[model samples]
Target: MYVVIFKAKVRQFDDQYSQTANRMRELALTEFGCLEFNAVTEGDLEIALSYWPSEEHIKAWKQHPEHLAAQQLGKQRWYESYSVEVVEIKRSYKSGSY
Candidate 1:
């Protein structure tokens, strides 16, 4: 498994940003090979973590047209700054049954 960690400092957000983000999340799950996604916001900061099956899947997601547009919009309007990291997951564990 692989993980994509995205951290951003929000700038300004409007209704369009919410719609776009929801659409993108749906695409990540349905179109891309995203296993799981979680995002949280605190103050002006946001962090999103997504799990994927492979780097190829991650690449495909990154190159998606709508996603590309969102990236541009994020930089241009929604986010002040952001950083993304792709890391291989050597192992993961759960304490007990969900």
Candidate 2:
């Protein structure tokens, strides 16, 4: 499994940002090989984590038109700065009740 971690320092988040975020999450889960998607915001910081089956899917997601637009918007308005990391998951363990 591959994990993509995205961290951003938010400059602003308006209604459009919220709509775009929700759309992207939905598209990723439905159209791509996205296993899990998670996001959280606190103060000026926002963090998102997504699990993918391979790097190809990540590349495809990056070049998706809607996502590209969102990236540009982030640069122009929503985010002050952002960083993304792709890492290989060596192992994972979980035991809980949902």
RMSD to true structure for each model, in Å: 0.8, 0.8
lDDT at 75 for candidate 1? 94
- lDDT tens digits by residue: candidate 1, 23-76: 999999999989998999999999999999999999999999999999999999
**Deviation from native of the Cα of residue 33 in model 2, angstroms:** 1.2
User: Candidate 2 clashing pairs?
Assistant: none
Q: Write the per-residue lDDT of candidate 2 for residues 1-98, one digit (tens) a residue.
A: 99999999999999999999999999999999899999999999999999999999999999999999999999999999999999999998888963
Clashing pairs in 1: none
Q: What Cα-based lDDT does every candidate model obtain?
A: 0.96, 0.96
